[model samples]
Target: MPEYQIFKNIQKHISLSDSERQLFISLVVEKDIAKKEIVLEQGSISRKLYFVEFGSLRAFNVNEEGRESTIMFAVQDWWITDMNSFINQKPALLSIETLEVSRLIEFDFSTLEELYKRLPKFERFFRIIFQNAYIREQLRVLDKISFTTEQQYTRFVEKYPQIVQKVTQKQIASYLGVTPEFLSAVKKK
Candidate 1:
């Protein structure tokens, strides 16, 4: 697929001029990530913002006991990054890893800042994306706090049907705050 398709999808949500589009495209660097590769590690600065061109990635945090808790997952056309590290230039609390062989379009922090200056409209596009992500995170938190495992699994399936097919049951269980066995039970019901 053309890189322009990604820009065009984003354009549907936020208008951009021809020059701005070209500039944005120029700032992005394409990369191929191997399955299970770590994109960002905890306690390291997240210098890049990634737009998935193909395949899936997951972000998670390790607990004191070394258990991983899934925070977010990004598939094709989704963006993934540790916002705190990217925006504040601080150490990241989360880690991002590819779940499968993936292609990504990435922009470093400096490049993004330059793009922001060259095209202010890009900020609006990012703001909308961030707002939607925030809302989804808030809902996920609420669901984990208030809903049963089955309910969480159901909601997850309804919200991201593609994820059910693409991601492992264990990963999906982690995202839903359930055990893989419990997820199987929920599915059976």
Candidate 2:
């Protein structure tokens, strides 16, 4: 596809031999999904990890009150999945939904295991990615505990301008752990 270059951009981070790359490409399944579609619903087994080729998606959970709380957003070049569920073959605690019409390359459990077995480097590649993800999650948790609402918004805006520009204010508020009304108030200031 015309977007091969963008996918290659991610491959550049971890060197893969020509044969391994060919095999990896063969194992991926490409999908095009509509905006607002739920690719992984809470309570369903999550067996795949998706790499975004275009557009965006959100991972979120519903509270007892039925309010949605966003955990993360994945855009082009990013990966999205319920990690625990995908790794353990358990029902997901989070739901993954597209925020825009999106193209994705997905790897299921069997293919991922085979990739690791066939190419040991593949294991290192994902290990690094997961380590970075874990560190980022740690920082976000610290921010949620220590930063003021306005400060959280500032950090978010500074770090993810693309998301701020494209996502709805309501969803942003939810992700920032604030109410829509409060977000509006913050914006006015």
Clashes of each: 0, 0
Expressed as tens digits, the lDDT of each residue in 85-161 for candidate 2 is 99999989999999999998999999989989988787888887788899999999999999888889989999999
**What TM-score quantifies how close candidate 2 is to the native fold?**
0.94
- List pairs with backbone clashes in candidate 2: none
Candidate 1 TM-score, C-alpha based = 0.92
**Model-by-model lDDT, in order?**
0.86, 0.88
Which 10-residue window in model 2 sums to the lowest lDDT?
1-10
Tens-digit lDDT track of model 1 for 72-175: 99988899999999989999989999989999889898887887798877788788888999998888889989998888888888999866777889888888
- Quote each prediction's TM-score: 0.92, 0.94
Where in model 2 is the C-alpha error above 4 Å?
Answer: 1-6
